[model samples]
Target chain A: MSAMIKVNLDLLLVQRKMTLTELADEVGITLANLSILKRGKARAIRFSTLAAICKALNCEPGDLLELDKEAE
Target chain B: MSVITIMLPALLLYVAVIVWLFVHFKSKIFSVRSGTASTTDNRLTRLVYHFLDFFLMFIILVLLMMPPLLVVMTISQFDNPEWGIDIGVFSNLRIDLNEFAGLVMEPSGIRNPEFSTQAVISIDTYSLFAYYLFALISVIGGVVLLYILLQLRTVFASLLSDMALTPENSGRIRKIGYAVIVWSLVNPFLQYFGGRAVLRDIAFNVPGFQLNPAFEIPIVGLFTGLVIIVLSGVLNEAARIQKDQELTI
Candidate 1:
């Protein structure tokens, strides 16, 4: 099975009209951490952290992330 | 005082706590049944809450057993001074390789070498075997518990994505995250204090070995705990927003 297409968190935030600065402040995460998450470079995400991000952005995790077929 | 006495009271207190949780939750269940006001149709919430309750019960049981385990180790060291094969004399204690090996190996044997000592203590090989088995079980149990919690998080996130984010839910999630962070911060300290106390009691017998409690105070535990809680919150919020957007579309 192909690896799932992960969410582009940065794009999601932009589409939701949420500034990175605002999201970072609301999530209580360092700007650096938020940057890492947006860039999809984070090694892992905790359930709680994901929940906070969703709550702040007013979006579902699936909206930010999705499963898609990998290129052959 | 032996470990048993301490454990008896602790066990009773733990049981009381468990009973209180049950009663409180049970009352909630009754209200849910009788009350005309119901908001959500999700059975997953109930499942998650029940899972949390069960996990807490297991944690309490593990906590209850810790003192007895420490006491057993202490008594074992005392009976077998040679059990602690000193590697060197760091401070007043004798440091020996054999003793260190014995600490990990025949821990109980080093304590009560005589068959006349309590049957459980005297059977050192069996005791070690049992300990190894229990440790394995505990590790597996922890892994399974973590997996279940993760699953619950996924479910919560999915459900939240479908709903609008009310101020009440937001506040509740924040409070839960704070509680989790606090618990994580305190846990290591408690473990260190408890471990140090047990080790100090046995230090007289294990001459070379020192109990290092310094590693317990860093923000590592709290950080991880906070991250987990925050992630859960993010997922729920994301779910809610996504749902609202879909409805709008």
Candidate 2:
């Protein structure tokens, strides 16, 4: 079974009217590394980083990550 | 006259290479001063390192041309009316004086009539071929090791900028380690065959004399390679950790 973790970070950022650069600064992470996470290329996310990102965006972890079982 | 004709060009070329390397390193010394001081920053160490680098390269270049030289030498030996072949596998071995005495004590009928045990040994074509083949292998191994060292010089140059722990440098270290291990593994056999080739002309006809091949194992060389391989892994891990830290925020 093919599985992919879809990051809804962009959607949350847009809802919060926050740019990736601002989120990265609040989360204390590099823009490039944050972009990697945002693009779903990260194999696994650290709980601390996830916590920081969710805190920065004022959102829950579930709102940021979801398992996509079906694809077009 | 023919020897002079052949050697003069080679001699002139070697001198040119030496001059060029000296100038190249001398120019590099100025640039190196602008960079951060490395482990090999001092004038003496740089001089020794560059000298060794150039010397190894010269040796490797000479070695690369050995197959042709061996062919010519083998042909000359073959054409030499004074020396003839001492055939058989035993012809490639060295026998001791005790073994000679023992051989003489053996039954006279058992000895070959043609092989005069007391004859002065001169290399035969077949032995030269074998010698050249093994020596060529050893030389190739040396060439690979020298090339790895040359690459390491670049890695060290990068180190002067305090950027020594990159993936590329770590990979170069691993390559050097691997090259050393390979050379160490092949060297013993090369020594054995090379020794045999060198002694190709000495006929060991001592009655009952047996032959033994000499072996030279590079245990220290093997250990050095293994240590370098481990250090490369450590460097790679350190680089990874540094990248993670840089990405952390």
Candidate 3:
């Protein structure tokens, strides 16, 4: 199986013009978890929470996450 | 006629149907597979199982409805002097014309008869039929539910043994648990409302038990049953999630 793509929450927030603190507060997610999510280090995201974040940021899920092929 | 004369044949038919269905499907459901490649085959098997499950539920509903339908028919056909004599331990139990008339009239006149000649206001034949029907359905439903629970236990064990759980599967299990919980909560309320209406129509007056004035009162028995089912689902989901977490670690 191909390597699964990781989310880029920081890039998503930057594109949406939302600060880390603002996004974290709006999404009801902890600052630490938000930081981990921004750095693409989080293991998983719940679809419900993903939807909430998407709504809060006015961005689609694809804008926050994508798949990339691992280097050979 | 002996009670066994009527009950025995019905019992035999019930046993035969249950046995035949179990024997025919047991092997198909429990058969070991060589490879895990065929998603199509798995889906087909699941579809078949679901169909059988629904059929069994339908049988239960029919069994339940039979008595009420019979009773309604009997009540419609009820006549004034519809009594039959039955030989018992203490002479013949008789429902004579005068006794029947007395019972029908005594409710208005307020004179309690002596213990020996205490007129038994016989239940309408249809009502008796309905009582028996409900009793039979309750017994059968209880037994079938127990059997299904046992089958679920075995299937869950086998599935756990054969496969490693994933987060996706765990999520699916949780969703199933939620569905069961919702069904459990709703089923009893529906049954209770239906039952309460029927009882009211029949003018049922049990000595100790009284229906609450509030129509919105929850059916506690149904709620308890639902709680049990939802708990089982929650436990299964928890187990799946634990397995997934262990696998991830």
Candidate 4:
């Protein structure tokens, strides 16, 4: 109840040297939606979308998502 | 008062309410920019909705005119004393038509049978009042029904494209079902009142003219309302699932 998942998509993109727009295009999602996900405002991410993002960024799901146990 | 005088104000009131609703829901109505590109591949379903759109409009026109028409026709009969109103009193009367059939078969025996066998009553002032009352009830009921149909048209127009289950559409469907149920419950009382109004001044002791509340329950309407209510539930569930699926991406 006190835990929440956070997206480290910005960090992953930085490490992968990929632009947000480029990642959005490669993942076949709108830039606005991608920004929402990157800003950690999304309620949940579909596994398929996460997989697509991971594939586009050349990273694992753990590299993009993080568990913030104390954020809540 | 005359039927037209009684009906005109009610008609105007109904129109005002419709206009108010349109103004209130203007944003929602305008926001429906979706085309008729339905998600379903069934051509038959598309055709049915297309037909319904026109049919609903025609029904609205007929409903609007019916009360006035009834009044006019009745007044004509009232004015002409020679052609008295032929009020049919129906019940479980078992008239043996076997003799009439035999007489008709034999041309020589088939003398001009008395067409005045049924009572032809003069339209008195009380009967005219009764007719007006009946027409008023019918008009009000019709206007309410028409209002619901117009609302339904708006709902359908908005969701013309991809009528996939949504919260708005589900709510509309639920409202329609509830409206129908209310109409069904109210209709019996209206029928009883109208029947009483018609029979209030008839001098003859007609069998079915008793001032009793013998209105039959509108079983078909009840069934339709239940079906729509169930459909609304199904639509809501479908909408939830669709949202989840869309999020699943």
Measured over the true interface residues after superposition, the C-alpha RMSD of each candidate is 12.6, 4.2, 6.1, 3.1
lDDT of 3 by residue, B108-154 (tens): 34345322232222333334433544454455455545455445444
lDDT of candidate 2 over B1-249, digit per residue (tens) = 344555566668668866876776666444444453456455555555555666666666677566665555455556455644443222223344343544455445544323324322334444555555555665677677677778777775665446777888889899989988987887777666655655544464555444444565679989999999999999999887766655442
Per candidate, chain B TM-score?
0.37, 0.62, 0.35, 0.59
Residue-level lDDT for B218 in candidate 3:
36
Candidate 3 lDDT for residue B155 = 47
DockQ scores for all the models shown?
A: 0.02, 0.12, 0.05, 0.24
Model 4 clash pairs are none
Residue-level lDDT tens digits of model 4 in B67-91: 6666556664554555433332211
Range of the 10 consecutive residues with the lowest summed lDDT in candidate 2 chain B:
B113-122
TM-scores of the candidates are 0.32, 0.59, 0.32, 0.64
**Per-residue error at B237 for model 4, in Å?**
1.6
Give the top-scoring candidate (DockQ): 4
Cα shift from native, residue B64, model 1 (Å)? 13
What is the alpha-carbon lDDT for the whole of candidate 4? 0.65
User: Candidate 2 on A1-72: residue-level lDDT in tens?
Assistant: 113778898899899999999988899978898898777666567889999988888889899888797742
In order, what lDDT does every prediction score?
0.53, 0.67, 0.53, 0.65
**Best candidate (score: lDDT):** 2
Better of 1 and 3 by lDDT: 1
**Candidates 2 and 4, the one with greater DockQ:** 4
Model 3 quality (TM-score): 0.32
